[model samples]
Target chain A: MNDVLIAVMMIVLTIITYKGATLVYQRFRRMYTAPIILSTVAIIIFLLVCHFSYETYMVGGKWIDHLLGPAVVALAYPLYQYRDILKKMVLPVLTGTFVGAVVGISSGLLLSKWTGFSELIIYSIVPKSVTTPVAMSIAESSGGVMSLAAVFVMIAGIGGVLIHPAVMRVARLQGQIGRGVGMGSASHAIGTATAMERDHLEGSVSTIAMVLSAVIVSILAPGLTLLLL
Target chain B: MSKAVTIILQIIGLYLIYLLGTAIQHTFNLFIPGSVIGLILLFLLLSLKLVSERWITEGAGFMITHLPFFFIPATVGVMGYAYVFKGKGILLIFIGLLSTGLVMGISGSVAQRLAGRREKAHE
Candidate 1:
């Protein structure tokens, strides 16, 4: 296939898969049916079954990837909408994000070291708590593999979405702000999406938390890697 | 503006912000992602009334709501690293899940305590 043709096909395929998965998620309302999880699984299966190479797939896939930058920037809309709440809870949100960033980075570094993973893996995992674009930059600057960082980030996000309700129940976490901050800071975008489904207040707070955690982790990840690694 | 024009303008505005972010990152040698810089820029623009929300609201809402769709391509790239998983995928999963749980627990508890204190103070 021509490169442009393949790229166009990939974009159409991606959107269809995502929309289809989203419908299933709405119908089932199950964690396993979450659009991100489902679309990734479905795409992977499609590729494997058709014997498509990752390179050929990415010729088109890269177009979607480029949009991720703009999508992230569009997050400012919610942040702008929720600015009043953000101003009111600035102290708690900042403190919570700072502490979460520290805990996430330190724990990731420690675990990777204990497992004797390479420096690259350690660097990649350090920024796993942040959203993908930020995490990729942090990983690159910190000498990690960007692709690996993206994978680790996806795992953290999916894991956070899956485990959050249970964690909330067990920990008895209260307050929409608390739940939002926890989910946003730990899981990034996916968790925030899930949070959005639960409540408007939670969703807005999650957006703030996601942005705040991204900024904090971006600043701290490299320094933490230098200090710990 | 028509819906199509609104979407186009919004995208152009966003792309411009992204470009500004890229410039700032290059100039300052900041570790921050350009998209994040763009986010901060957009936030400032919206807050200051420099950029009317109505112009971008429709498009931004659409993008944010479908945020997961954009991520599908990158997530699918995971298949490229089958060897890493084969080598110590379990270890990676263990660390990722463990850290996620720890982060959720710690942040939730801390934010809850702080929020509680604030409520009490307000009361």
Candidate 2:
């Protein structure tokens, strides 16, 4: 296939798959059917079946990936818009995510160590609760495989989103604020998307949590990785 | 201006911020990514009223709304890592689930308690 042709195909395929997944998500409104998970899974299977390498897919996928940076910068808009609410809820949101960040790293470290997973795996998962790009950086600084770290980050996001309801119910969390913080701090962007789907205000708060948790993990992960793992 | 031009310009504005952030990160040799630096810089600009919300609103809204879509390709990289996950796939999944649950439960409970307390205190 020509470069130009594959480029168009990859971009079109991603868009079509994403749009189809969005429709299914709207219809069923299930966690599993969410566009992030569903479309990624569908495309992965499609690629595997076609025997197209990830590098090949990236001929166009890279174009889409390039948008991630601007997307991250766009986050500042939401953060600024919600400044007043964030200020009011600062104590809870700050305290909750701070604790959550520490616990996220320590728990992953302990569990991975106990299970005899490789040190590389331990380093990869240490920052799993943060967003993908930041988590990869953290893992890299810690001598972990950046790609493996990204995989762990994705697992954490999807797993956190998947278990959100059950955990919320059992935890008996009442306010939307807490739920937002919980989702963002644990799951990062994926969780933030889920929260946004339900309520804009809650989602806004989650974005703050997501960003703050990312900062917190970035600051704390290296120290913890050295000390514990 | 038409909505299309407005959106395009806003995106360009955001892209400029992104580039500035990357340049700063490179200059400082910082561990943080350029995009994150851009986020913080943009936030500060917004907070200080140096950058108007209207400027980035349409562009940011579009980007934020479609944020999760951008993560799909990276997440799909899992397919190539079957060997790394081989026997320990379940274990890794377990660790992810357990840690996430713990983080969520704690953060949610903590925030709920404190916020509720503040409400009662005000009352």
What is the TM-score of chain A, computed separately for every candidate? Answer: 0.87, 0.93
Q: Pick the candidate with the highest TM-score.
A: 2
Report the C-alpha lDDT of model 2 over B1-123, residue by residue, as the tens digit: 988788878988998999999999999987677887898899999988999898898998887777778777777778887777667667888988899999999988888788886534422
Tens digit per residue, CA lDDT, model 1, A1-229: 7888999988898989998999999999877788888998999999999999888889999988887777778878877887776677877777887899999999999998988988988999999999887898888887899989998998888888878878888877777778888999999977887777676567767777788898888888778878987
Q: Candidates' TM-scores?
A: 0.90, 0.93
Off by over 4 Å in 1: A140-143, A222-229, B117-123
lDDT, residue B78, candidate 2: 80
Highest lDDT: give the candidate number: 2
Q: DockQ: which candidate is best?
A: 2
Q: What CAPRI-style quality would you assign to candidate 2? A: medium
Model 1 has an lDDT value of 0.84
Task: For each candidate, report its DockQ versus the true two-chain complex.
Answer: 0.68, 0.71
